[model samples]
Target: MPLLNNENKIPCYIQNQLIHDKDIKSIVFVNSHLPADETLLVKSITLVKRITTVSVVNNFTKELNLNSVDISHIFIFLDNINDIPSASSAIANQEVFSLNNPKYYFLFIKPTDNSRDEIKNILDQVWKCHELWKYVLVFCMETEWLRIVSYNPFKQLLVEFQSDCNNTTMFSNMLKNVNGYRIKTIFFYTLKSSKMENGKCRGNDCEVMETFFNYINATNEEVVLNVTEDLLYPVSQDYIKQDRADVMFNNMFLYIELYKYSAFAFAHSNVYAVVPRASTLTFLTNIIFMFTPIVWIGIGIIPLIYYHLLSIFDNYAIGKHHVRGILISKYVYALIFTCIFQSMIITTLTSPKYRKNIETLHDLFESNLSIYGVKDWMYMFHREVAIRYKPWNNTSITSALNNLTLDGAYIVGEYWLNLFLKNKTRIGGTYNDYYYKIKEAVGTGLLTYYTRRNSPYREIIYKITLLRNMAGLDKEFGYREINFTKALKSKSLTLIHLQSSFVFLSVGWILSTLVFSIEVITNIILQHIKTK
Candidate 1:
């Protein structure tokens, strides 16, 4: 009751004196109007409050060499205590003074703007001193909005201004986009180490490359197959030697290229690439037709006719009128007639409209002794007879043909019939050498065909060969020998041989009669000239 007297000056002066005392550890200012200097003094006293505690009083006195006559906890309050420069000075002093007692903790009350810079400076000091930052905590108060923000160097603080914010949906969307996005492309990188290895697969463990064809077919994704490099060679390998080892690799590469091309075409259009089998009789027959001397003979005849015509004209221009002119005219007529007859024979033999009778290779194999003028007759014999003799699944083209030849069929073809010979050598020991003999047996015009019409797969086989040749891939197998005997035995040729032989003979006889008449007329003209 006595303290309620109107004279309040006594308690305020006493509190100010207590705050100024050097023994005070804690300062709490409770006046409604705190003077700026007094508020600064309160903050300074609070910064060193722990030093005044009883347990460390003697230690603090000893370290600082200060007299500890009295100790007390003091408190202070100021409307804008943080606005005073003494607050920052006190914080800096506390940071340096507390260095000796590393375990000591301090609490700072700061305005929001000063809080960030203060915490940053403290963290910089801790980092420079190599001190543990885990214990440092800063509290900042926004008095205007009544909001409190707390910061720690070692911890992340998330303060949402909104009370009922939903972060889960935002976080989920961010994660979904970040984790589930991918770019579309198939990349094949050729490494250096493998490229330098001789006889190595350039694929570099990439035999099974990914293709968009399957993906698009299955998933309907608008995918495209793009090949960056059409050909990749081993870095330091000799191309010629590596070719053999690279055969399979090359095959795979070609397969991919072809697949891509085919897929592209199929996607846009309806076309597809076709692969050919070597064992089909139609394939052999096509080889025979392509290699036939008749075709070559037909090709050679044009130049021969031109040469003959040029010779005749040259003789006429040189004024060798009596001797050279008459002789050249007769020769020209005979040659022309012969060419027409031969052309008719070839045309009738090769005509596709008149289908051949013999359908199978067996028919040719069993035929009576017949002459063959083909270059690589071994392949024909093998296809017809020897392949059937010791046939095995997965047999190579050369092996099947060799087996056919070993079964007593004669093969006549070019000496360098390398394709048939090389394959035969690969499969047959004794008969491999027989290719040399077969090659030596090639003859001119013994018998030949315009085409092999009897084989059912003729069209497909020809298409395959043509495509391969067009792509320059046919050299891989080398040239095949032509077997005219088997070719003529084809059903198409058999029908032609039976039905058109008479017409050919008749034409030939008529050409011979004409030749004789020309000779007779030349003789009569010579006699008349001699009489003149």
Candidate 2:
């Protein structure tokens, strides 16, 4: 038996019996005396015996890799009362080595070190591993009676800081109480990327982000937020000027002095960041059907006009009873019908597929109209749009709007673009070119919130986002376009449709006038000859 003291009063059999009763798999003896060939009666259990000194105990983690090895039981035998303080300090520092990870711990100490201060210090180190003592079995070996006490680590939380926070004013404003978990704030603003670490980002602040960050650092919080690391990706190169300046001028007197000089002049104008909304502009199928009526009306009018003209000719000159007149009229009617059908068929075959107008991304690509994007950035996030438009960065959307170039198409969010287009009366266009959308939306990124690996508040935030999305808040936020139920009315004719009508009128008038003039000239000549 490893002697608890010089007397060695505790029997090896009793210790083995207690250990066997508990069914402990592995045991680690620290600063305990045992023979080189010592074996416990329980052959199934594994034993690691170490007679470590104070110096070795302090640097014990170096000798043993706790992550790779498993020790179910830990027996720390305090040799001297003075060694108690050093051992406690060593255990506290190296708590990661054998603390909450073990399934069971058997700590054998002398009854003399059971004073209030000594016991408190020893237990304090044990609790550092988070909610200890559930698996711990403490025994104070006394001469007459053994003193055993059970401690529960979770009964009272030791104030080793309840929460953590990064020093930012926005974070302070956003996270409210976080389900009653007190945040122990430490100002250290760090980021994995130039990613926006917030769910609801507005300019320079984010309420969702602050709340999430605070909730993440809290000790008792166990919520898992379904969020990505990068909530918003600013395509601009100079997004992190604030974070960068903070890092560079962190200890600089001159930088602080310069900030004082320039802060008021810029004010908050340049401090906030704005991300453009992402969504596809879909083609309105309803609008395309609106033009169907006009096409039918135009085709239907051809036969009607032909019959009306034949009736007019019969009333003016040729009687229906005359065989020549009847044959001529039949020939003319056949020719007219043939001409109309041929023209309709040829035009339909030659022209490209019918699109209501330039509305969808596919329509934009197919149209002869040039695509205009931002001058500073390429709006190539969506692959198909990027490939077709190939985004011209030389001219901006603002400039394009200002110019109101009739030959080009501009890509922008629906709400703002619609508003702009509604007010754009200066541009002389008969078509409502403003209300257009791409049918397939390019899903490049999503706006999401992040939490710590295990946070209790995660599910709450997730549900909030789901409800917001379901309510179509994206439309409210201008990420989605207005749902236009009404289709385009093609009753309003364009130049192409009127061209055929004008040609028929022009030819009829010209031919009638020429025939009348020829008849009048012949009559005058005959009368002149008779007078001569």
Candidate 3:
């Protein structure tokens, strides 16, 4: 047995009892008693063992920070009392590795140096910074006793554990239970993605959050979760900075983030909007659009004009004019033209045409119609929409629903998109193009949950995200345009569904402009000729 001291027979409880399960990331640090056989360092008891001197501890720590796994189970043994002060700095530096990782540490001092004041001094030197112990579990071994310091994440406090059993049994149990952390009071800010209804926070985003927090809130009967939709802080970063919030339930990922906290992601959503789909053609234009300009002159104009001229000639200068009334049949042309016109009218009414959808951001902005976006979405992605090009910024949630009968478009975020569509379906009871979601997404990244850099709850939140995603719990509440795309494909017709008609109207407008130009030129030429 590795001696705790020259005469003590404690038997190194960890070296003998630890059952390595292939996942325990164990590391051992010894300052003296070098063994020539390197294989002992590679055994199951010590996956990573290093021999360190006082002068080289800092270098070793830096190397470990760069190469070690995010979480660590470390056992550090010091041979000399003077080594504590230097080891304090090196051990404290290990806490700086990752914002989301946790560390379980066991520190054993020489039997002569294992005083309570010595442990207190080490705490002061290593954890002088406030709350650095949040993600670490510290175990200090004594000859006859074990001292441990743990942190409660929900309550946001360091707790010294209390045990009724003897040190040996408690020490063994502590090793077995070191894998989990305790819970306390938790503050969740739901302002970023949820709306307040009768003092209850609710929305699409809140529902997704409930998939995790609801499970967590019920995980322990003692857990206290204070979920609030307070708007006192305008942004999520402010809530974290003010210490009023422990985590942001949902937050937009901005290009320039304000917090240094770890972003714990729960939902991956993209922005979608219910924009207006405008018609490209009109009723009268649809008729003209069915036939080319040359066909128009040949089928109707030239035939009528030629017949009229021949009639005048036959009445006067008298060609025999099919003399015996062996007829020319004008009714034949009438029947044919009438049948064509009737066919076109029926086709145009049923299958109206509209402008190609404003699917891309460039096209939506360039469409030149007024656009409105939710105030929160506008503020979150303000980098892309900084300039208020139009005075169409929505000041309220009710504004999105108002677009159902209105002409303009509204940008609905992932959180509000589903609710907005539901309200639209309820109002119209059928499909309408006035409030339709564009097929493409507008945001740059996924929405995430934000926690403090030293937050002990981050690991739990990560696990919840993993398991919830694996079980498809939150996916039911995620952003979906599948149904909306189906709505657009529905055969039901409405006044707003006149897309093909608008295309016809545009073509008619072009032809009208061409005719107007010719008439103006001819009038100008006639005036000049008469003046001369």
| TM-score of every candidate relative to the true structure | 0.17, 0.30, 0.47
Worst 10 residues of 1 by lDDT: 265-274
- lDDT tens string, model 1, 1-532? 1211223322333344344444444222222233444444334434543445322221111233323323232122223424223332232233223222222222223334445566455444442233222122222233312222222322223222211111111111111121222212222233321132365334322221112112212111112324223223221112212211111111111122122111111000011101111233553354345324654564456456546654544543333333344355445645654554455545444332222222224333343223232222223233333343332222233343445443222332232233234443444454444422321222221111011111111222233334434663334232434343433332322323323433443454455445555665776788799999
Task: Give per-residue lDDT, candidate 3, residue 333.
Answer: 37
lDDT of 2 by residue, 183-232 (tens): 22111122211123464233211333354455434332222223331221
> How much lDDT does each candidate structure score?
0.30, 0.36, 0.44
Q: How many clashing residue pairs, candidate 3?
A: 13
Please, what are the lDDT tens digits per residue for candidate 3 over residues 54-148? Answer: 11122434635334443333444555445555654554445433332433343333334445555555544433332344222223344345444
Clashes of each: 22, 13, 13
Using TM-score, give the best candidate's number. Answer: 3
lDDT of 3: 0.44
